[model samples]
Target: MLSSYNNNKVIYSGTGRRKTSIARVKLIPGSGKLIINGLPGESYLQFSPNYLRISCAPLNILGLHKEYDIYVKTQGGGLTGQADAIRLGLAKALCSVNPENRITLKSEGLLRRDARIKERKKYGLRKARKAPQYSKR
Candidate 1:
């Protein structure tokens, strides 16, 4: 997590990961706009309200949804994982903005990273755990 000033404007940044997804988030003081990977957040998320809500959960929890703009660069994984990663990153940035926010974010479990990832496939297995059908005739 880091916060820096650009042209006298403050920017708070944080990184988050979920599954195979990684999101780099920045919080800028402005109207509540969300831009991801140079695209509008809504369009990037395919206009799914669930994704929008998940990505902005932290700000909504803090009643600062309209206070800061969210900018993110995310890659890998599906939309669900990306959305969660963004949420965590945003929460971290908010904490940098106000350390006290950690208490609130933590209580809501927003600061915790989801560690579950895809299981590796073993030799002779069809998938991570599924094996080919056996014929004992």
Candidate 2:
């Protein structure tokens, strides 16, 4: 028999990764807000608005009109990458909240890590694909 006391206990935990960033997220029933390493979301925003927007997309997609009040600690990447990581983390966290939502989130490609990144420049190439100055003899 299941114990009634365990009803509200945490049922899921998930990790999200994007680029070089990793986001550890925890989801609980509550209004949406982001806490990064104990700092409020606003603090992070002061550094990068793009991060805040990308990180918040998951909540909106889940029809969580109000904020979910997420707590995240991310490392090893820039603001944009961290935000993308957090979005992935939050989506995974949501799946734990309700497995039924997985299909919808997956369909939106929220679960997939973006593989696009800057290609390395060749020694003689001006850029990844651009050629160096051409001199006609």
Candidate 3:
């Protein structure tokens, strides 16, 4: 939600969350390049094609993939969660660029935040729902 002008350059930003992961995304006008946590996105994502694709899905859908540089600072989740968070964040940033883009992004379901998260573990259970086996003596 941080949109501002830096030296006459417009910056659009958005925040995303998935599971325990959170991503802060900034969109700046430039060739398509992704930087995450001060590292190149490709390397940070471990060169995974799937991760790369998921993170860039929104831009591709709008055919504006090459018009913006993505800068992200993500934490608190694994790669999968982080990738998804990035996708959502990017979609939001794109929407701020142009309101019309929301229709397409929303239709494709890119704007929806995944709400599934780890359930809280109960004190009597070994996990969120798993219980210790009962003895049948």
Candidate 4:
């Protein structure tokens, strides 16, 4: 996820995944601002305060919400998935900036990957676990 940064500036980065969504996130020293998928984070999320909060949970939890700018490129899944992915990626970037953040992030459960995804349907079932019907004649 972390590509590179020039020596003239400092940037931290990481990758985050949720469901089928993936986000590449970068953090830079600047006033709080967010750019995601070529759109401002707020605008991209349709100005939904809830999703904005979810995407910045890790920063808010660590009191760094106003200290850095966030950049995210995300695809796949829906808005919620992308937001959670950003949160996880931001947590990882924070850890890279300060190792001490590792414990905090871990304690906040931000460093854990969400592995749950859609289950495949079984060969003889209509769904992952549901059967077509029961005949008792």
Q: Encode model 3's per-residue lDDT on 1-116: one tens digit a residue.
A: 54999888799999999999999999999999999999999999999999999999999889998999999999997999999999999999999999999999999999999999
Model 1: weakest 10-residue lDDT segment is 1-10
lDDT of 4 by residue, 24-69 (tens): 9999988999999989999999999999999999989899999998
**Each model's TM-score?**
0.97, 0.76, 0.96, 0.93
Q: Which residue pairs show collisions in model 3?
A: none
Task: Please list the residue runs of candidate 4 whose C-alpha ends up more than 4 Å from where it truly belongs after superposition.
Answer: 1-3
Better of 3 and 4 by lDDT: 3
The per-model lDDT (C-alpha) reads 0.95, 0.76, 0.95, 0.92
lDDT agreement of model 3 with the native: 0.95
Candidate 2: RMSD to truth: 4.4
lDDT of 1 at 124: 98
Error of 1 at 24 (Å): 0.4
lDDT of model 2 at residue 68?
A: 55
The window of 10 residues in a row where model 2 has the poorest summed lDDT is 1-10
Cα lDDT over the full model 1: 0.95
